[model samples]
Target: MKILVPVKRVVDYNVKIRVKADGSGVETANVKMSMNPFDEIAVEEAVRLKEAGKATEIIAVSVGPAQAQETLRTALAMGADRAILVQTDAETQPLAVAKVLKALVEKEGPTLVVLGKQAIDDDCNQTGQMLAALLGWGQGTFASKIVAGEGSIAVTREIDGGLETVDLKLPAIVTADLRLNEPRYASLPNIMKAKKKPLETVTPDSLGVDVASRLTTLKVVEPAKRKAGVKVADVAALVDKLKSEARVI
Candidate 1:
């Protein structure tokens, strides 16, 4: 089985985020960067499949600027066999990204595509489904469990009610959810080893996919700051405050 994992380069979750001075986007200058957390889960799942002998080759792909190579290298350190960089200068919408991945799937002819359920920055949660539609393949989104089979794959997904299982034919797409697995950090040795991993760079035109974005950002703004509240001295005071000052009742 060959699994293609699509990843993203985003602001490190641990770092404090700052809005750009011009309000066009987030400030990224001198900012620490890392792989998307959800993508990390997807990568971990793909690596586990390889470790379990269920997957043969794991190809990690990232679509973004040249800096995205760093994110792809992180996937290699985590055990991806190869990397593909779909070079782009600005952030591409989910639809455009799906188009790029669809082209890749055709070129690589992989048995499966794994992706994060949603990106941290955009939170669009549309690429995997869009790619599946574009390729006319089945999709299992928010997958928490995966069972590789001879001719198909069983995926346990998280639904609003609980968990649901679906069997997808080979050459399907799967998106990772939070409960999939805890990702392991790359060791220094692995990081050094990843330097030798092959990363093939490609352009959207190379695949003959139109890169027009389906959506456009009309405006960007910071979230309103949460207001601080005062604490009451006693349980009786709390009840009084809730009824009067907080006006709950």
Candidate 2:
């Protein structure tokens, strides 16, 4: 089985985000960037599957600006056989990314596709489902556990009340959740080897997918600062304050 994993590049989670001065978007200029955390879990899972002898090859893919090659290299260092970067400077929304992955799926003919549940930068959480729908394939999303069988994979996913398990046939999609697995750091040797791994770059136009943004951002602004809390002397004072100031009573 050939497992394909899609990764994303985003602002490092540790960095404090700053709104652009013009209310355009978050300031990414000279900001530290890294692979999406959830996608790292997805890549680790695929590599484990290959190590377990259930998968023959693993491919890591990313859709973003040319800088995203670094993100794909991170995946290759994690044990992916190769990497593919769908180069695009435009904003890659959920729908456009799904279309690009769909085109790659057709060309690569992988048996299974795995991706993160969401990218931290956008937090849109729509790409995996959109890709599954476009391909008309079975989907098991937010998967915490995955077991591959003869021609299907059983996925245990987290739900509102509890966990739910579903069996998806081959040529299906699975989105990795937080508890799926802990990601492993790339070793120095592997990191050096990743530099030599085949990293193919293609344009959205080459994939025949029009990546024009359908949604427009009216404005982007920083959230309002939270107000400081006030202390009350006793329960009676708290109740009075709630009634008069908060109006909860």
Candidate 3:
């Protein structure tokens, strides 16, 4: 069986984001970039499947600008056999991304597709579900555990109050959650070996997929600042302040 993993390049999680002076968007110029954290887990899961002899081949794919190849390289170092990059400069939304992945899925015909449940930058948590809908396949989202078999896969998912397990037939979509597995770092030798791995680039148009942005960002602004708390001398003073200034009596 073949396992496909999609990764993304995003702003490093540790960097402090600042709103642009014009309020157009976050300032990304010259910012540190890294592979999306959730995607790393997805890649690790696929690698483990390959190691366990459940998957015959592991392919990594990324949809973004040319620089996204770096993210694919990271996945390759982690143990992907090859990579495909759907290169585009246009700002892509979740739906468009899902369509792109669907196109790739049709072309690749992988038995399983694993991806991050949500991209940290957008936090939309929609792509995996959308892909499953487009493909008319089974979906298991926010997966914390995955056990693959010859004809099906069982997934343990994290829910609001507890956990739930679902068994899906082959050719399914699984999205990784935080507790899935800890990703291993790519050693220096593996990084060097990844450079020799096969990486093919293609445009979205080449795949017959239209990636036009359906949503518009009118403006981006900073959230309101939190006010400092006031200290009162006594309970009576606190009550008086709440009744007078706060009017919460």
Candidate 4:
């Protein structure tokens, strides 16, 4: 069985984000970049599956600029057998990404596809579901635990009220959640080895996927600054302020 895992490169979670001077988008120039935290979890899960003899080959894939190859290398260092980089300089939307992954799925014929629940940069939380829909396959999103069986996979998911268990047939899509196993750091030796791992680069057009953006960004602005709280003289003053100044009453 082959497992396909998609990873993404995003600004470091620890870095403080800044809005562009022009209302365009967030600043990303020369900023610290790393694999999406959730994607790291997905990679770790694929690695675990391979270690358990459930998966024969693990392929790490990334869709972004040329730099995204770095993210795929990180996955290889984590234990993926090989990697693929979908080279595109455009800002890819969820639908476009899903289409690209669908194309790869058709070509690779992996029995399982794993992905992060969401990318921190967009926080859209839509790609996995979209991919599953596009492929007409079973989907297990926000999976906390996964077990491979004879011909199906059982997934324990994190839901609103509590955990929910669902069994999906082979060739399904699973999205990793925070409760999934913690990712292991790539060792120095593995990092060196990853450099030699097979990494193929392909354009989205070559895959016959149109990546045109359907949505337009009107403006990107920083959130309004919160106002400081004022101390009230007494209960009566607080009530008066609430009724008059704040208009809560």
All candidates: TM-score: 0.92, 0.97, 0.95, 0.95
Per-model CA lDDT versus the true structure: 0.92, 0.96, 0.94, 0.96
lDDT of 3 by residue, 100-176 (tens): 99999999999999999999887889999999999999999999999997699999999999999999998999999
> Residue 37 of model 3: what lDDT?
97
How many steric overlaps are in each model, in order? Answer: 0, 0, 0, 0
Candidate 4 or 2, higher lDDT: 2
For residue 26, model 3's alpha carbon misses the true position, in angstroms, by 1.5
Cand. 4 TM to true fold:
0.95
lDDT, residue 43, model 3? 98
| lDDT score, candidate 2 | 0.96
Q: Give per-residue CA lDDT, model 1, range 46-132, as digits (tens).
A: 999999999999999998999999999999999999999999775688888998898888889899999999998888899999999
Report per-prediction Cα RMSD to one decimal: 1.9, 1.0, 1.6, 1.6
lDDT of 4 by residue, 1-249 (tens): 999999999999999999899989989999999999999999999999999999999999999999999999999999999999999988988999999999999999998999999999999999999999999999999999999998899999999999999999988999999989999999999999999999999999999998888999989998899999999989999999999998989
Judged by lDDT, which candidate is best?
A: 2
How are the candidates ranked when ordered by lDDT, highest leading?
2, 4, 3, 1
- Candidate 2: stretches off by over 4 Å: 247-249
